[model samples]
Target: MKRKLGAEDLFKINSVSNPQISPNGEEAVFIRTEIDEKDNKYYAHLFHIQLATGTISQWTYGKERISSPNWSPDGQSVAFLSNRDEKNQLYIINKNGGEAKKVTTLDSGVNSFLWDPSNGKIWISSKIKSGKTFTDKVEKEDKPLPKAYVVDGMKYKMDGIDGAGLVPQDSYSQIAVLNLNDESIDQFTTGEYQHSLQAISPDGKKLVVGVNRADNLDYVFKSPLLLIDVETKEETTIVDQNGYYGGAAFSFDGKYIAYAGSDHSYKNATHGNIYIYDVEGKTTVSLTDGIDSPVGDYAVADTQQGISSPAVVWTAANELYFQLSTMGDVRLYYATLDGAIYPASPEGEHIYDYAVTKDGKFALIAVSNPTFPGELFNYEIAAGERKQLTHFNEEFLKEVELVQPSDISYEVSDGNTVYGWLMKPAGFEEGKKYPLIVEIHGGPHTMYANSFFHELQLLAAKGYGVLYVNPRGSHGYSQAFVDAVRGDYGGGDYTDIMAGLDYAISQNDWIDTERLGVTGGSYGGFMTNWIVGHTNRFKAAVTQRSISNWISFFGVSDIGYYFTDWQIGADMQDPEKLWNHSPLKYAKNIETPLLILHSEKDFRCPIEQAEQLYITLKSMNKQVEFVRFPDNNHNLSRTGTPNLRIERLNQIVQWFEKYI
Candidate 1:
């Protein structure tokens, strides 16, 4: 056989995701994605999985992939948005399926939708003109104009698709009330922040949306909740008591609205807290109180995306069932309007997100831990029993050893306790000294939960101790705790992670601190870059998809403009503040060998940021090399092209082997 580069060899298989049970709760509908190696593309389709008999069936086919499916409350049909007609349009199908019927047509199409309680209507968040009448020449009148000269997606240029369409940024979004009967559309709040999460109240009249009308709304991490009295055309802020408040949902009675929110600090340790606002009483209470859990553990394979849209399942007698991840492991926890919260886990590993049955006796769960990938499981509360339904990755686990993360709590310099997870070598021996790799997570707003990450586990198997932490900005902590790291990015949160390292070295005698190495992507990438510049504690580092210069990052990155303001309360326009928060400001102090791995087409971080770091490191005579993957996005490390994914792993191994 010809010699093959593992990074160039493709072995990734596609997976199914976003499974949602029909309104009637009979069968689960999921989006199945397949990667075609020939074109290096992912094709998605809607598939139906039965809950009772474990039967599976395929629904859509051939031309386009269907996404974001919502079932009509009557359960007779399902509505989905797709790019099937070239422009994304609403398509509906019967309970079983015959042919999907097109339900709406406009110049721009739908991106997301919610069924209007079986009133033959669907509410979608899609681009629409502010005041343009439905009858006007829409393509000419309402089609978006480029807000920024070079749109981020589809490369840096607004390349003409046969001059067929405008750049996506030129494409603006609005929440539209789509009346399925007459194909009539009503625009709600043409006010600016690019509409998202259009949640209709249980009664289907009050629409709870994430709207940003303020000019500085762009500075906000997430849009504040906007409630619209659809019939009266009156709009009001549900609880504009600020700071990134999008994931809002109404209680069964519509009196209480629960949402997932985080304060305005973008420090690396931010985790979202559950907040409930009483509409009638006009009061707000921060739930997920005291029970802090890491969102996604560094032990798991993920892009560091934290929990948004907390899976809130309704209860039989007016209570709400939700999942909480305190201590980095997810568990099924239920709470009522009466203020009582209790555990509902009936067994091992841990419960994923819970699915509540209409009758409240059943809780459908996706369960797993370090040893297992999530499997479909069910808990019958009335029967007081739980059983595993389907094994998702049992075959794969048999081929490889999975690492079990050990919970570790240590104190910060401030005398505050911090939590983290330690993944030991697979066939660990107590006496052997192993090199330790600190795998940090991004999202300064995300977490390092106790999930499974093939990379971290594989690192441990390579005779390295893997340590991941919740380090403050990480979720599963108190809202105030998460908010603590903002503006103080490299301040306290930095001290926490470093303190974590110090504690680990002091506690674990087997860790070779001299052989220490570190690496992370995005904010973690930012931290990795920050760590090397601040101290030479780490011998080597790999910063993937990171921002080295916050000043330049604002204009170049797709999210930099907003991300900067969210993290530090100012954008690059405020160069003084931006520079003060940037890792690049102190680059001359960086002595550690740094490897910058970046995607060629990552709009989120953009390749330029990586280029700047790599160039500066080389100029300073520090051993540095940049590995740029083509045709990849911000998801380069977690969910990128297969050939490139393994290559990323191989590069990390090579970097550590050479430097440390």
Candidate 2:
């Protein structure tokens, strides 16, 4: 037998998403995403488990992949959106066990669905029927039609395991209403407006929807929330609440609306605020004011989802739950909404999305760390106790070694204190200096928290010190901290990182700053590009799945068009601001050995972004090389081919060894 690579040796698992607590809170239903090595496809399935005994009652089967399981409020039936027909559609399964009833017949297929609160209809949204699907398809006008087409609701363009879908062009699941009993569907918010930001009240009489009227649709943060009456389908905008608002939900009683949004009135700062909008009285109050970071983020959980956003649940009552990240660890917190927000912090390594039971006694939280893949946990909030539920991968412990990161903090650029985590070599010596690789995270709005990351640990295992930071614009800190990076791209954040390198060298005389290296993906990648151009503080750099040219990104990336408008507050058509913010603008200044890692099929940052940077740097005679993962998309880090995953690690280790 052949020895397996570390990643292959380690058991790999991912989320099934939205493990719904049964309405009664005594039972729960969830989807489990597992890899089928032989079939070479990711499969997700529904499983019914009693909350008390922890024994599961399997629901769906066969080679067909089913996902997005939503339990009806009554708990007798489950409604899920499946692509079993190749054409995704809504299907109903009963708790008592029976054949699933396919609900609708549409060509483009249903992308998203919601259980109707008042009636038995399923609210669904799809871009299939709205227009013909197209994504850089090069077809001759005289050739036969692509099999992905359908005369009505039949042909589905799924090329692989029927799950890894086509890169979403204009096709996305919007918000709408579908009547389950009569198989009737009603389209809401017509005329070029996508009901993207949407949530239905418990009574099913109201919907809080976010719509982007801007030509740049990806400016989700700039989109405004509108209150719609389910009865009349009438709309109203709550004043003093304009900006980007999504992930909105109605309280169990429907009196207030809770959502994560930012104050768009100001251009320089952004922080996701938790707002409670009084529907009848028309009043909006911002929660987490002093505690929130200026740069806002997005999260979602429906009434059916096991855990709703704590920003929504905590304000009304006393016990509130929310997700927070500082450094690279993402965890869940149960706060006292009544007083000063005091976090009921979890003691484990990582606590991500969580749910509060209807009885307000229990919670189903997602937990994971370096070696521990995502495992389900059941907690009793009052008792201050928790129990592990689903063991996604138990055998991982048998073969692989998990790396643990120690949290580190240092002052940067300004007087601002920044946080990060450092992973030393497995057999690290206290007095010896080692080559340090600095890592940055994406989401300029998201955070790098205490969680399990294989790549970082593998680098440490390869005998290198790894440092990752949550510079300005990262969440979990106060709003001012996150908003600190708004229009100041390479300005403060770059300095913060440089200061961080100095601090790391100071604390760990073991760190060899002269042989130091830096790298990141997405926004982190953008920062990597920015860092190389601005300062040669590190000896080597690797920019992965990153943004090199914002000017071109505004035109090519899937969300770049709108993202450029909001992040820079300028359109790409104008070369002024976009070029100024682009890392490519300063490519000539790059002195570090820059290696570009990218995915061929990436749309989020696009493969061209990497090509542009590589070409520019090589042309300028700077030490640069480009490596592309064929057939891989933007998510190569988290989900990609097993061979490619190990290869990715190998390339990084080799690059740093050669140059750093």
Candidate 3:
């Protein structure tokens, strides 16, 4: 007999990411992440695989966590970043395996770095105090002490950087070149502005960098791309500061540049589009104008850290591939120079992370589904055949009876179609009534897909039927549909979710309507609060890291002030409009047994959002309880401390079990 997935099973799962195919397309390397349950921390190590033999081997090991593994141009050495010396610095080791040697001796560690096209030098992105000779000053000093922060901008600090504290707003990120032969560093692109090197040209003469030259008032979301001359130290604007653009790269021939970003015409609802720039013609074109899907992995992944899948991968100068979030799945698609788009992935599986070989013959993808966790697979582009390469979780998966969800669709009041998934409880029986739990995803803009969701599976394992939907405000729909909820937060989007639930129940006879529960986090949490206040249908509800008052949210959240203006169409200038959409405004109407879950250090949706709702419900003698996780951020469900993540899931499961 197989057992249902439980909270503790999280410890057994391994995370795979950052697959880099060798130059000859015969081998590949990636990072395998694991959690030390006793230490409550995560570790990442390098792993190698041969495409022809499927033989896997570990390259590096120990307590140090490694990331950003890359192969040298000649495939003779592997370079990566590690925290072995208590600082994230660059390290390189031979391909045949041996002890790694440190490359950089900077006082302040490197954030991210990339190998040069010729493998002669490397460009590193690192933070340094902004002043004259600041790079040299930091190199001479010991571990610098914490200084008082005088914040002057709305985008000063964030939660995930170093836990719960305000960060230094004065320190700027600078790019430096390290000569591999001489071990000398030359700091380039200096000033008050911050620069991040994205890609280098094929000849290693020019660089694509994103620079923020604005003063105090402007946000850094729309930094312009600059083409920097490596030898002359001169800069030219490739894409100007009129819109949001980043993740830039030079094509194989250095004639064109491909980047993933968008103009902020629709604010938070704007779809991320892939734009290619012609360096020679001085023109740009959007490759995914009609796709209507987000041009990257917007869906949350449950991993040791928040892993970002590559936004664009170049197969050739004329052909490039990118991942798009459609409905709930992140699928791979390729675009040609003549403006043709086609799917490059197997159907019904989410390509969370992928990398194409230099010859464009094979692609290594981290694929998963409702019943499967992450696994490495090699996809042949022309033959369209996928072969499994890594089986890190095969043993655990074989012993677990996971619940597989069925795809569903329904029409809302406005005749717009909504997509959703319905999963029966584990060991489900025919004609047996089961309690239902409506799971709402965060990023009211993010959609639910056929991906493997650990939380949903745990809910199903605990004997509750699950239903999750992508409403009007979600991606993977029309642009008009995605932008539909910008000004009307709790209006049509709420109706769409409710209609989806009714349709789900009507289609399934075994769902017990009276024993219904609902839960969500972030924007989804706001929707859960909105649903309970507007209706008395759900027997129980749990809101995680939610927003109660948009008025206060404007001043507190990391992106609160501008996010309010972008998503809600209101800011500090319009307090009344902000309050009108606040869920706390209708808290008096809530009678469902409500459980509030929040993180103490969440800068995105602060703990105060949960406090206000908890206090309001308690003052009215309403049934409510509040739970808080210390030292965690808004990513508590996705990438929080491993034990806390399991506890958070248990809290949701126990709350629904008690009330339903």
Candidate 4:
């Protein structure tokens, strides 16, 4: 008998990502991630696959997590980053498979890296302190054991996977070149600004870097493009810091460089565009000027840790490909240097990551769907034949009853058609009424897409029908639609969701409207709080890592000060406006029983946001419960410790089961 996909299945689920195709396209290397439930940790190992024979072999084995696997241009060696030594260091292994050798030993772990084909050199971006060698700085400074922080600047500390509000830890990430033969490191760029390695010219003469040199404290939005001479280390600003830009690549002949970016004309809701820069002319032109979709995956998730999605994938000097979010999916689009573009992958599936062959005849795509975790597929570029190459979860999935969501649409008040999906309860029977849970997504800007979501699946297994929607202000829509909820929070956005719920209820007789519950995190959490305050239609609500007061969020959150201004259109300058939109202002009206779920160290929407709402509701004699997870961040649901993740899902399911 088939069993429902429950919370414990998280341990059985195996996922693959970051398929790096060799130069000859004969083989590929990708990372396979599995949850170590016994230790409550996550682990990843590199695996190699032969394209012709479909033969697979493990390349590395260890407790350390491996990421960013890159094939050498000559295809003789592969390099990747690992945390075997407690800090992320560079490791290289032969193509034939043998013991991996450590390439670099830096006190500050490598954040990201790129390989220079012309020379056996590696370019890395890492955080380094000033005035001392990184190792000496760490040792001599005797970093204070402070439970308190002396906060400084608009952006002081960052939210790591660990926790938040810990310390005012700051470091400047700069570029460095490491010579493999001599093992000598050369620091190229300097300053307080952070730099990221983007791309190297084909001849390895020029390097492209994304540098954020914004002078003002409040100007945290721009990252300009910089071209550095590999030898002289001289830098030229190819693109001004008037906006954000990165993911750069040079043409095969090294005449033009292609990059992705956007001018902040629309602030946080601006769609990204592709641009080409002529090295000789020193001029840049936008290739995708009128496209309504974001250039890359703005709808992000913490599904797989240590995996990165490249912004632009160039198949040729004249032909390039990139992913864009549209409707409820992130689709791959092929474009020419002249700006013509069309979809390259299937329309309805999410392309998590992809690798193209040198001749551009084939592509290795990492794709996922509503019922699929993630799998690799080989696609013939010309014939459009997509063949599944790997089935990591085939055995486990075969014995489970997975719920498939029905794509639905409804017209909201603003005349825009909102897209959503209604997932039936697992092992459903016709005409049987079931409890409903209206699940909301975070990013307020990010959308619910055609991807596998473990939480929703687990909830469905508990016999709850899940309703999730891409309302206004979601990424996978038009620029105007995404920007609609910025200045007008809790206005039309709320109506769009309610309208979707109403539409779903009207269409399905099996939905027990009286037993409706709601839950969401981050912005979704804020919306859940908002919904309970405005209406008591939900019998139970769980708000996770949510925002309650914009005023305090502006001060405590890692991105608070500026994100408040960018998203809500109000900052410290406008207290009344911020307060008016805050759900805390209306907390006394909440009648539904609320379960507040928060991470003690969530710097994005600090846990204090949850505290304010919970305390306010309790003060009003409302039924409320707050649960705090220690050493977790805003991504508690997606990337927390495996044990905590299972517990979180169980809590939500049990809460609804008890109340609804």
> lDDT (CA) for every model shown?
0.69, 0.69, 0.85, 0.85
- Model 4 per-residue lDDT tens digits across residues 1-660: 888887889888887888999888799999999889887888889999999988889988899789999998788889999998989999999988689999878888888888897548988888887654434446645675746557556666678744445532556788888888987788878887778899999888899998877665565667888898988878888898567788898877788888988898878778888898999899999888778888887654445455577777776546888888988898888888776888887767788888887677888888888888878888897798988888888987798888889999998766899998999999889989999999999988888888888888888999999999988889988899988888888889899999989999999999998999999988999999899989989999999999999999998888888788888898898999999999999998899999999988788888889889888889889999999998888787877878888888888988998899
TM-score of 4: 0.97
Query: Candidate 2: where are CA atoms >4 Å away?
Result: 1-5, 9-11, 14-17, 128-177, 182-190, 212-221, 238-241, 265-269, 294-320, 325-340, 347-349, 429-433, 534-537, 558-582, 585-591, 640-643
* Cα lDDT tens digits for candidate 2, 135-200: 122334786765553322111122122223343344544566777667766666565555563678
Question: Which of candidates 1 and 2 is the stronger one according to lDDT?
Answer: 1
Residue 88 in candidate 2, Cα distance off native in Å = 3.0
Model 2: lowest-lDDT 10 consecutive positions = 296-305
What does candidate 2 score on TM?
0.83
Per-residue alpha-carbon lDDT of candidate 3 for residues 361-477, written as tens digits (9 for 90 to 100)? 789998888888888899898899889899998888988889989999988888889888899999999989999999888887787777788888889999999999888888876
10 residues in a row with least lDDT, candidate 3:
132-141
RMSD of 3: 1.8
Count of residue pairs whose backbone atoms collide, per candidate = 21, 29, 2, 1
Clashes (candidate 4): 1
Go through the candidates in order and give the C-alpha RMSD of each one to the true structure. Answer: 5.3, 6.1, 1.8, 1.9
Give the runs in model 3 whose Cα sits over 4 Å from its true position: 132-147, 219-221, 303-306
Q: Candidate 1: lDDT of 425?
A: 67
Worst ten-residue run, lDDT, model 1?
1-10
